[model samples]
Target: MSYADVNGLSMYYREHGDAPVTEDNPALVLLHGGLSGSDDFAALVPELSAHRRVITADLQGHSHTADVDRPIRVETIGDDVAALIKHLELGKADVMGYSFGGGAALRCAIQHPDAVRKLIVVSFPFRQDGFFEDVRAQQRQMSPESAAFMKQTPAWELYERTAPRPEDFPQLVGKMGEWLQQPFDYSEEIRGLQVPTQLIFADADMYSMQHICDFWALLGGGQRDAGWDGAARPGAHQLAVLPDTTHYAISSSPALAGTAERFLR
Candidate 1:
């Protein structure tokens, strides 16, 4: 239970487990999905923290963090995350995010490379068009009016239990709808990334398999074969698609932690 006054937001964050920070074992940061809070990662953090400290935070306008006048955009959230990392005096940390948080993590690595040592993006795409058309259509339909329907969901329950102002849920929903409507593509930036990255997805993710492979290619993956000694492989970037999981469940999958630990180590 801690809050950092970073980037004009009283960002809520917490640390779990402990280990000396080093290039090979930097602190790890976890970011939850859209309309979700740090608590969503409560089950996964311990597994990830076994070898190093794990930091989890609620992004602006979600969960314990109150909504500000600013709109909820991935770029803005990315800046907030970078600010928090500095606020904690973490020099640099390994960042891992799921879904909406994953998008922010990627932007953080792209916009504030110095603040991140390694990156993990789970169940997110580098381009707006990477999402299936029907999924995009569904996102477009999100609005304040849909709040009642969402009330039946676990996300809504979490909001009711933890949000600073429960009534603002609809407003948050509206802002997310507006943000999702905006189009963006960061393929060039990703291709030029200097930070080590690992992209993880579910077998039945919201994104098409082709789009996922394209995103990996941007990370210098899936391009060539590794020789017998693995000398011809691309950069340190890696990709993993968890079996028998959907985007909704990938973050909680036990395999997710194991896969990420292997890369983080």
Candidate 2:
């Protein structure tokens, strides 16, 4: 376990295994889902770190990383991840994030393209409205008061176990609620991205399938067919919808790790 002083926060991060990070074999940085910490990737890290160094971090307001005065916005978290990369002096690493982390990873690639080699975004929508109405409603209903209910959930358990200030859980919930309620659409930004990227999602995610397809289209995918000789392929991007998985469980799915490994290779 380690902490990097970046972006005005003591960001918690840890490394698994060891490997020479080269142009052909870059390091992998992982961002976990909302309300989850670095340990959220326990199922995927071992396999992923087997051949390369895997870096996992607890984002702002989550786990051991104490929150600062800043709001919990994806853009800011993305910048923090980029700063951490620079702080560690790892040049051009591959970044993969899940759900909330996916948004941050995408933002990182957009805001700091030079720091990333390739990107993998899992189980997160590109637009705020991409989520189903029910999910959106739930997000809007969240508040600091909801902390009482969260105490019965696994997220709260983890928070209680690892957060530097466990009493701030309510404040964290409030910040997330505010951020989730805000409207956002990154269609133009995603279309303009130059980084090689991959999109992963569960067969039944919280977001609509139509929205997911639109996201792929924005990445220059699903519009045409590649030639039999593999000469007419689309952009260097890939998409995977894992079977028998849901948004909450996609990050832990073995298929998720396998697909990501193939894409990274």
Q: What is the lDDT of residue 190 in candidate 2?
A: 94
Q: Write down the worst ten-residue block by lDDT for model 2.
A: 226-235
| Displacement of the residue 238 alpha carbon in candidate 1, Å | 0.4
Question: Model 2: how far is 134 from its true place, Å?
Answer: 0.6
* Number of backbone-clashing residue pairs for each candidate, in the order shown: 0, 0
Model 2 per-residue lDDT tens digits across residues 74-172:
999999999999998889999999999999999999999999999999988999889999999899888999988988899999999999899999999
Q: Name the best candidate (by lDDT).
A: 2
Q: How big is the RMSD of model 1? A: 1.0
Q: How accurate is candidate 1 locally (lDDT)?
A: 0.92
